[model samples]
Target: MTAPTRAAPAREWADAFAAASNEDPEIQAHGKYFTCTYLLDATERSYAIKMESGRVTEVTVDPGPLDVPYEFAIRATPETWRGFGEPVPPPMHHGIWAATFQRDMRLDGNILVLMQNLRCVTRQIELLRTVGSPV
Candidate 1:
């Protein structure tokens, strides 16, 4: 038999994030009414995730530019993202706060909004490890 196909990274992440957020009471509680469009800028490509009330409602891969406004963007090289996706990430790669300070991961725009939804966002990021393999 042929080998099984792996889901695309963006699709896998989106599905896993949605499921994880919906199942976690803390994520749901903290994210109530938290709606935003955020971009993930990987070294080779970019994606936009539309989160509505703590759920990842949509994930668009390689969306070059947008007419619609995005609340913020998070960027990191593919290597950095791969580090974060490890089952047990090293010191700086363990979380967004750490990564932002110690690595090349960046957060831009709407800092206030991002901080407001920090907990939910953290959990969503953590779900990266659960959903797909890093490129």
Candidate 2:
């Protein structure tokens, strides 16, 4: 039998992240009310991900200080982000809450928005295990 064909890998972290989030079944099924924009700040770089009804509308890379508008920001050191990039993150690196409380990670800006869309946000971020971290 011929070998199975696999789609070409994404060229960059942003591309991988977008592809992963956009094509996820969980996001599509439960994201009907998940609409928001947020920043994933890795200290080394930043990604502004905008979601509309559970779909990733846009993903801006390294936006200027005021170029892109986001409701909240998940900020962390590059070192901390590397831990998240792992396929199986270590104890303190497992989730946003864990890292935020245990590592050098911060959730800033409008926190209520983050909480409002917490479920989808959590699922989207969990995609990092498959898509890897942007840092």
Candidate 3:
């Protein structure tokens, strides 16, 4: 199959994440603990992923401020995001914690929620490589 766009819309990423998560046993097992909307701010654009009982029920691209009450928000520069989306990301780009520690990504709002669902979030991010190509 042809590679996806370098900067594909958030809906695409969200859909990919949902599909990947559904197929991942780890995500499915741990996703039950996560049931909330999360915002992904790609600097230039934004999207929201809504998870219900460990399943991704909705993905909204360019969601307005009041569209969703996100439990948390993850923000990163487009450049940083491109790195994270690599099939085999380098150090500091391999995971959200690494990126956050390296100052490449930022987490805003309920940190506790993010921590509780770290595994699911990480898997979702890893799936990014499958759907998003380098810019």
> Which stretches of candidate 2 lie above 4 Å from their native place?
1-11
lDDT of 1 by residue, 30-126 (tens): 8887789887778676777788987777777677675446799889988787777777887788788888887599999998888888888888778
Native RMSD of candidate 3 (Å) = 3.5
TM-score of 1: 0.83
What TM-score against the true fold does each predicted structure earn?
Answer: 0.83, 0.88, 0.86
* Candidate 3 structure quality by residue, lDDT tens digits, 5-113: 6765555666776777678787888887778889888878777888887888887878888978899999998888888878888778888888889887899999998
lDDT on C-alpha atoms for all candidate structures: 0.75, 0.83, 0.80
Candidates arranged by TM-score, highest first: 2, 3, 1
Candidate order by lDDT, highest to lowest? 2, 3, 1
Q: Which candidate is the best by TM-score?
A: 2
Q: Write the per-residue lDDT of candidate 2 for residues 1-135, one digit (tens) a residue.
A: 977522222237788888888899988888898888899988768889989999988889888989989999999987787787778888898789999887589999999999988888888778887877676
How far in Å is the alpha carbon of 73 misplaced in model 2? 0.3
Show where candidate 1 strays beyond 4 Å. 1-9
Residue pairs clashing in model 2 are none
After superposition, the stretches of candidate 3 with alpha carbons farther than 4 Å from their true spots are 1-5, 133-135
Candidate that would win on lDDT = 2
